[model samples]
Target: MSNPTELTHAPHRDDVGARMGMWLFLFTELLLFGGLFLVYAVYRHEYYSQFRVAALELNLSIGALNTVILLTSSLTVALSIGALQKGQKHLSVMLLLITDILALAFMVNKYFEWSTKIHHGIYPGSEHLLNLPDGQILFYGLYYIMTGLHALYIIIGLVFLTIVLGFVITGSVNKDSYVKLENAGLYWHLVDLIWIFLFPLFYLIQ
Candidate 1:
């Protein structure tokens, strides 16, 4: 593949339908996350003390760090899309690389945070649980379910972006036809937005 800098042009899609489709999908994603937030709202209110303790036990710093990582990645991806729309090929590719590294940072932090929780017997079906009260168990259960589902979705979103980033890196996207990169950025922003709410609800609310 030629160096991205060698290509000075980029392609922008003029398709109204494509843009509309992306927006519609984003709306659907918002609804899905809204449902999860509703579930958290209901459960946390029901088990306030236990949930508070659970939240305190959570790695707030990790969540905060990941939040910044994802947010910065979103900016880079947005900038990449801008570069394409502006016909700047090299800038788009470099932005994509930056976004990927940010994504990697986010995922690595999640790994360390989850592993720490696992070591403390926080995972479901763990044989060495500390045997807390029923309310605490319920708190942990909700915490795991809500956060687990969110994290799973994040992983899937990252995989989709990895594919798009590869397209950029390999020159398939190049200086033209970068619609896929923009779409991928949209999805990544959705992932970041979900975490924004999750962080406040799970950590700050307590």
Candidate 2:
């Protein structure tokens, strides 16, 4: 019969496998977005002037605000993971809640930006966009597709973090077993990284 102390100290598989699997999934996501980036680069090169003109139609202030929001959210999620690792469950939950609020703020800003554009008759199939030059059309097309996809990822990350928050509250994720929160943090960071790229390409370019 095993001693009670020995039973408590029994070895189990580390979380390395779970982390590796998450990394692999993230690699696939990178490839998918990389292809889109390549396409954007090709078209931007072909229509440099038109692309610049099209980009100017976007709101720099709103884009920059959203960038800041996502970056801050990323930091919060990282802190949440750290807090969980340190056995600070209440702090971790509060951090996650802050992250969620930031994510919602981002979506709200995005909604207003898009709505303003649409109000001005600037959208995928609108006659205004259809009348623009081919390069301009391509620019707006890529802008919509890339930003929309990133927004979807943000929503997914928020949902995942919410679920992880529940797990933390229920004690499924704690100082000893918090890989779930770490994985959620990884996903949230990925979303922020994508926007980091998108921000400069779409908003900062002249």
Candidate 3:
């Protein structure tokens, strides 16, 4: 006959292991973005003057607004995790919902920015860009690629946070088992951090 106490005490999941795995995944993501930044730096150094001109075409107001939106979202997500830890389920869910809404707002702002650029005949393969000086062309090219990739990351973060919200509602990620939400928050913060780097590089540069 099996001992009931031993059966009850058996380990079901390793929260530590799960967190370690999440950190490993985040490290890989960092490496990917680091490589992209390296390319941007090399190209920008080669074409500093033209890069400044290309940057002027970007709307600093819109970029700053998006930066505020992302930073606010990061705060909400962090607060949500804190709420969940304190066993405040409703508050946690509401904070997460706000985070998701902020993410959507960021995307909307990005859409308008891109639309304006495209309307001005400024895209990756537009003849307008091609005919520009080589330095300007390279600047615009890197700008589009980096910003596009960051926007994709925001979309992905929204989807992941939505799933985590669902989990929280179902009580699967409550105070005792909040690893899922924690991991999701980590991902969102990463997206925000990348934008912090991007905003200054592409917008505030003189």
> Against the true structure, whose lDDT is highest?
3
Instruction: State the lDDT of candidate 2 residue by residue for 105-197, as single tens digits.
Output: 999999999999999999999999999999999999999999999999999998999999999989988888888888899999999999999
Considering TM-score, where higher is better, how would the candidates rank from best to worst? 2, 3, 1
Model 3, runs deviating above 4 Å: 1-11
- Model 1 spans > 4 angstroms off: 1-14, 127-130, 170-176
Candidate 1, residue 130: Cα displacement in angstroms equals 7.9
Q: On residues 10-100, what C-alpha lDDT tens digit does candidate 1 reach at each position?
A: 3433545676799899998788878877877787778878777767888878888888898898899899889877878788878878887
What is the lDDT for 51 in model 1?
A: 76
Determine which window of 10 residues in candidate 2 has minimal summed lDDT.
2-11
Candidate 3 TM-score to native: 0.94
Instruction: Please report, in order, the local distance difference test score of every candidate based on alpha carbons.
Output: 0.78, 0.92, 0.94
Could you give candidate 3's per-residue lDDT for residues 1-206 as a string of tens digits? 56453566845666678888988998999999999999989989998999999999999999999999999999999999999999999999999999999999999999999999999999999999999999899888888899999999999999999999999999989987798998999999999999999999999989
